[model samples]
Target: MDGNTNEQPPAGEETPAGVRRRPWPLRRGAAPTGVRRSLRMAGVTLAVVLVSLAGVVLGVFAGGRVDTDIGPFQATLTLTPDTSGGTTVDIPPLGALLLDSHDGPTHLTVRLGALDQMRTEALIDDPASIQRASVSAVEDVRTGVMRLGLRTVASAVLATLLLAALVFRNVRRTALSGVLALVVSLGSLGAAAGTLRPQAIEEPRYEGLLVNAPAIVGDARRIANDYTRYAEQLQRLVGNVSQLYTTVSGLPVFEPAPDTTRVLHVSDMHLNPTGWSLIRTVVEQFDIDVVIDTGDITDWGSEPEASFVGSIGVLKRPYVYIRGNHDSGRTAAAVARQPNAIVLNNSTTTVAGLTIAGIGDPRFTPDKNTSPAGSGLTKPVAEQVIGAGEQLAATVRNSPRPVNIALVHDPASAGPLSGTCPLVLAGHTHARQVSMLPQQPGLGPTQLMVEGSTGGAGLRGLEGEKPTPLSMSVLYFDKDKLLQAYDDITVGGTGQAQVNLERHVIKDPQAGEPVPVTPTPTR
Candidate 1:
């Protein structure tokens, strides 16, 4: 009432009559103008990046493959985003091999499809044809790679532009995003090309059944370092391939009768990955129903070595295994885990209409650190092996089903089982031998069959002057489940490209004397 018409109320004081106070425009839950602008820019940038990535994924999966023929082999090549830049050669059921062939942001994969049998046979018959095929293969691979690269680049650009237009919804922004994506794609490819490493072929990492790469390729470093030597090695490789085809093609055609069962007998694999390929090929080619392994599957029996047993599952046939002197309890457990694998330890199991009994060797001599003192390290005496064999014989006699085959790791262990089963299979001498034990009182005489090293004694074969031959046998059984005949298959060791197959037929199964009456060479 002091009569100051323009007088204003102090901050926090009540407003004057007839005057109104405006509320704060920036109320709760509202951000500042500068902050809002920054958030909008960030959101737009994030959207652009996400869309670009999606475009790349679409490009790779939709159109990143090319098919071509190399020599007599048909193959498909593909490019994919991967930080570990390398090349992978996939050979289907045989497994894959990875090579550090280059350095880049992408990976290259070559999947082999089929082999032209006629072309292969021609190559084998004509040495000049081999030279022509090798030259043609190189040219074909080069052209295929170029086509694949161009298609991948074009696919990426098109995909990026389409995605950018959908995301930005503006001509200017979409154009800018497309340019950015193109720049990135081209840069990545340029970087890969600039960092190529042809020498990486000297050291390839093998996977699956191709783990025998070293044995097959034969010292890649040596070949790469010397050009003249490389030429020789290449010729040898071609020769080996031709020899392999010849052997496989010459195999006797087996038309298995409905009631007849064929079993593949292998032993002393010694952890050779090539053995897997050999076994699988035989299984498919011969129509094998059951596979019997007489032990020594691994060399060290360590945890890492246990992984080799995975091949047992891949075989897709009933695998009967027993532990050898070099195999530990852990090794046995690994074999047991494989699908379709049967681990026998003083036990019996029926497979393919044949009742088989087996027992693990008592000795474990590979690694002293893992094996127990004395008994594990020392060589088992004749008495110890014979006693173990006696235990297996007792188990066979007590089985609910009549045992037709007795399996043991050592030949000595098979002695006590002479009359327990009709056929006794054993390994661990690394030599093939067949003999008929004297007739027993109650049971028929036993036919003892000992197999050699199927893996050619693994890597140890390289140490000797002459590599040991890789050996396996295919046993044919009659409809009555009686042993009839077997074909002994032997492939010459490293640097040797010879395959020898001997067919031995048993004249009389019930007779006390059984011998290889006629030994015929199939190849």
Candidate 2:
């Protein structure tokens, strides 16, 4: 051995004793430490970015349409990009049942895709099933989804590590370890996203008996934004339905009296979609012969607002609609599209065995005034209402039906037809009231009923005032085709709830009394 400190290894000669290993393949001077660090960090950064991008692509495109069966009800749902630049699930009402199950007056919402078996419990009427489905969904996510996500994350980490090793062959041992740690953490995040798989939602179900089920569907591409919101809404509806079943389970199931005509009078929906669902419920429960709506159906009566007209079109029952102050002729045109709707404006017609005549609001929409601003005794509001009432009174002058009912929007205009009509129904004021108007000597006495806003004062009603309960009247006719018992149902007032219905005995609707309610009540 030579005694030289700076000696190079001899060609083809193996090192004899204590020669140390190098941190890299190359000589120390050929590449500086800084260069090696740069290589390792750059490779790692690139690998991390690729992994994240892949994870995002997978997350966005992973979900597709899945069939969701909630007991006897079934519907298809999927999460896709929404026009609102979010994700949402679109579900058409499975049947009339779903079409009529609304959360509130105007808002219809459901998140069928977010419910795993566990969350679906709320939709079911039974307590045990809700518990089971909820537990199962949670377990599936924890045991199945978590395990699958871990596998994906681990695979991603291993692949990125191998690729980084290939690209940075000259990195130091310390730097390699650091790079591995960084890659694993980031890769774990990318893989964890797989755990968010909403496909599991298709499994959890609302399985059990349900008193009523609404159409549970909507655009759900926005589920990523807030799945909890839609999920909770479905829960509340399910809870309410459960409450209804619980309330009536012990009582006698109602069967209408023979040869009796039931008319459900609802007014001032004011574009509250919830009312239609309630209307459907009342009609089904009462075996109603005809459904009548005193208008203000649309708030502004604009073109876009016309879309809600489709809701009324779905009612399979006989429906009679009259225009109100907030309604336009176009509103009537929309009502005409509904197969069962009776357009009884300024015309006397017999429907459901009763003659009905109506007057359209004089002003239609407040902005769509009939009176061109003129120098007259009164402003447009009074002049318009009177003219419309006169037109209606003119048509009913000869008496069309023995039990003629007059439909108008304003109660002020309802009295003129007292002598002509035995029963007068009007809606415009957002409060409930009843009055007796003794007619001129020869005619029968008239009862003027002004129904409270069916929308609980509507969406606009929610502002500036304590919220009112949704209100409407169910008028029952006797074998003689005379008014007998009327139910004034109020749901969810400012401080009241649980679908309270009060039965009023109108011993003689012709007596023009206040129409006292019977103490018997159903919640």
Candidate 3:
């Protein structure tokens, strides 16, 4: 009997059932090879599918939603899926953050997609977290090299393929197929990660703000809460001015320019004499031909009644005063009384080579939290609110001189009217007590800024900081219609005894050339 044949069993090779000890050479040798080939192809196919899906989900979908925020003084992030419809994301005020002290240590909030979220979070906390997360997310996508996920499935497939190649020589280079896939997938993922989330500064100008976001967010939160509380108290205080402690004299003084544009961009005055005095100096020094008081001329509906009205008279330039929410009723009557002052209740004006449009406060206070002196708490009708926005639109549209400038008190209104006019000057968010760059889009790239009294800049308002303090923006427009110069006049006298003027020039975007203005003249 031959080994290949079925014959009587030998002693050692006897079958368990005592049958023939015949080895079917052809069938026995081919079984392992066939099984291995099938397993290898299946494993390779699975790896390809997973890598492809991950590329689509992470690269295509996640790349579009990258946005950043800084300052409420405490860096905290709330990430919600931006579902089919609209999404409302509430950025917390600094006061709301659960923090220990009012200073030190920054925080970061990162949002990752469903697939990589857990892995990414682990990497963020680990020693080489950032590097690992970024590498894992993109290794196969860009480099076409083997990544963990791709490599995992690839290895399994490759093992089977290697076995198959050994079994079936006619299969033609089965072992090398996985190597190609590994390289291609790794390269693809790496490319996708680099393109989508580069480690370098996305916006070089905003880099500082982004870096400082964690710490700033914490401080800003507490400041904002204090402001809101103060505003509530001040609202009641304005009803009885005798109780107020702060005065205009305590505010910073302004230095007027020798030559006058006659335009005054006074905003977030907050009825503090310090701010008013600074505004007055700027007006007189510049010999302003016209004054545009954007809003928040008064601290709140409260404060010494005379302070808000008197501050207007103090400006040497004839002014156009718009009502800010803080002024509410207190400043309206006073504005109406000023013969030289054009009181725009969401109206237009053409004065001194400028076509100016004004909008009153745009924020909707659901309830009359507090009323002006002697006036009962009153909630306005919906139409009145809508009408105010319409009036602003109409005012801009009807401007006789091709709308050169826009004036409003609340910086919030700027969001709607930013690119509409050549220049938009507003007050509310008084530069955040310590000013930084204007963080609004289409505003400026650099974080260069103006300081507010107790409140903040428009960025603060966006951060939910209420009743930003007093400051003024002075814009100098040349004859060619280019804004030659800009100035942020600080309004208070706390740290600085006198008014401080931080000025800069507008660089032309197309030319990348700076258009210089005369240095700010000293008082």
Error of 3 at 87 (Å): 53
The estimated TM-scores of all candidates read 0.52, 0.52, 0.39
The sequence of per-residue lDDT tens digits that candidate 2 reaches over residues 1-523 is: 4988766665445566756534335665677789989998887676656644343333323422334443322334332222222122233221111222111111112223222332232332232343355456455433433343344334444444454445546345324534554554444344334333445343332322111211111222332222233223323332352243334323343323688788989988876545656666666666678888888887656543455666564567888888887777777887888788887777776777888888776665433221222223266566666677677877888664554688988776775676777788888877788877657788888778888888654444444334445788888777666777677876653333246656666655568554454333333
Angstrom error at residue 4, model 1: 82
Cα deviation of 424 in candidate 3 (Å)? 1.2
lDDT of 1 at 520: 33
lDDT of 1 by residue, 1-523 (tens): 6899866455445565655655445768999999999999999888777777778767866777999887777789999988878888887644677888777778889888756545554553343455577689889888988888888877877888898888778887677667766776677677777888877765777776557546553565453233232223323433342243345334454333578788999998887555666677678777789999999898766654666677677779999999988787988998999889999999999998899999998777563212111233235465777778999999998989889889998887877897887899988878888888767788787899989988767655544556667789988888878787777887665445456666666668776344443333322
Per-candidate total of colliding backbone pairs = 0, 28, 63
Alpha-carbon runs more than 4 Å astray in model 1 = 1-256, 367-380, 512-523
Model 1 clash pairs are none
What lDDT does the true structure give each of the candidates? 0.74, 0.56, 0.43
CA lDDT for candidate 3: 0.43
lDDT of 3 at 44: 66
Ranking by lDDT: 1, 2, 3
- Top-lDDT structure, candidate number: 1
